[model samples]
Target: MTAAPVKNLTLADFLHLPYVEESPAWEYVDGVLQQKPMPKTRHSMLQKRLLTAVDAATEDYTALPELRCTFGGRSTVPDVAVVVWERIPVNDLGEPEDHFTLAPDWTIEILSPDQKATRVIDNILHCLKHGCRLGWMLDPDDYAVFVFQSQRETEVFRGDRLLPMLEGIDLSLTAEQIFSWLQVKRR
Candidate 1:
């Protein structure tokens, strides 16, 4: 269910509001607080696997799990956020900032069973509009993945079809392998 806006708020005002960082995860979009559905085992499995794969394969780009990104007049926490080494925000001591001020280079979202695909897609599109190079919406229920490239059409990848990685990432993964991570091993 969509969370209705309690009141119209500017980006600055919304940032000051408490509990956005606390679980259950809340997203601020269209001046409303939208609560993210709880993640199931399948959702957590895929998110972890993808982040690990992308992080290991690329040296210049790093993928972080559940990073809250604030940009494009909205604040959201992508399941995974991949940003280039230089683009990562750092403070006076060069440590990464608590919050990202710009859009991620790539954003990944895993679909919860009760969530609407359009809502996730809209978030991906919003990221693309503000300099996100790529986005992926993983739907475990449908066993399909939607790949979004900046300025291009959305493409669905399934089964053994290779999911595209970032320009220099060099990691080749398939939808089958991604979903397989959810399967528990037999003892």
Candidate 2:
């Protein structure tokens, strides 16, 4: 006996599927289901530090980690998703909507050891093609970041060079500064 071939899930079905916040996020890309790689210590540290840094640097935008964004017929969970305050949808009572049906203003992904860069880059490009302002792919091990912008070539940043930031955001983060988050200070 052989196992049955798994059927691809539709976007609606994928969205309707039960999800637990603590579990790895599920993504639907081109009618395929994928599980985002679990964040390791370095990845988690960068995600948290980047989110805090971005949020602290600007009041016009907010950053969230592992937030699922659906748009352009695909759903992706970026390591850090930044949305402009004005673009965030609110409900009748003025609370933020639970479901984000649009691409984030800035999509950030930190590369994991077991994750494939091409796939991550594909997601970023997908977001860019669908109105995302900027994308950053951070490689912790290399202490580098790849920046993506619509209608432009991808740029790599390292050392003291500042990474590209979304418009309206006042952050001036560098690759070195971002990678430095992994170092634990011993008192």
Candidate 3:
């Protein structure tokens, strides 16, 4: 027997569904769904390193990995999500949900070569507007990072400077160090 055709679901409908085990490659934007292509090796490595460093630095807090969150009907899975320890919600059993409903305190996105800068910037801006305290857009090719804070201005860092948001956290990696990690060695 032929199966019934599935209807295209809106972002609202998507959220009502059960939680997914694996993070999907789709993002919801303005009531429409968009697919993100698989990240390249450099993109993947940078994302992993950033997540590791951020988690290590904020060990006192409750940070999560690729957690699904919604902001104004848009569902985005940020590369790394830092949730302030105190602000974390407790469940009936006195445990926090694996996924968060609100925007994270910090969101970081590593731009893939094929991804559009405007789109990535929009995501950062969206996070800021929705109460995210900090956001970072790392450009692998240019070795630059664009930092954004809610209710504040945006800043760009290049070369050998430490990021401002990471000041209290004491992260000392420079742009050169970040890019160098992406390089492959010849045997």
lDDT of all predictions: 0.87, 0.86, 0.73
RMSD of each: 1.3, 3.1, 4.8
**Mind giving the per-residue lDDT tens digits that candidate 2 earns over 1-187?**
1112237767888788786233688788887777877778888888888889899989899998888898889888999999998888999999999989898999999999888898899999999888998999999879989999998899999999988887778889888888888889999
Q: List the residue pairs that clash in candidate 3.
A: none
Model 3 segments more than 4 A misplaced = 1-9, 16-24, 166-168, 185-187
Q: Which candidate's lDDT is highest?
A: 1
lDDT of 1: 0.87
Off by over 4 Å in 2: 1-8, 19-22
Consecutive 10-residue window with the lowest summed lDDT within model 1: 1-10
Q: How do these models rank on TM-score, best leading?
A: 1, 2, 3
lDDT of 3: 0.73
The best-first sequence of candidates by lDDT reads 1, 2, 3
Instruction: Kindly list the per-residue Cα lDDT of model 3 for residues 1-187, writing each as its tens digit.
Output: 1112236777677666564223445676675555554677898888777777766775555556667777666788776777777767788998986656787788888887777788778888888888888898899888898889876788888888877653335467777777788888889
Count of backbone clashes, every candidate in sequence: 0, 0, 0
lDDT of 1 by residue, 121-157 (tens): 9999999999999999988888889999986888999
Better of 1 and 3 by lDDT: 1
**Which prediction has more favorable lDDT, 1 or 2?**
1
**How far is 131's C-alpha from truth in model 1 (Å)?**
0.7
TM-score of each: 0.95, 0.93, 0.82
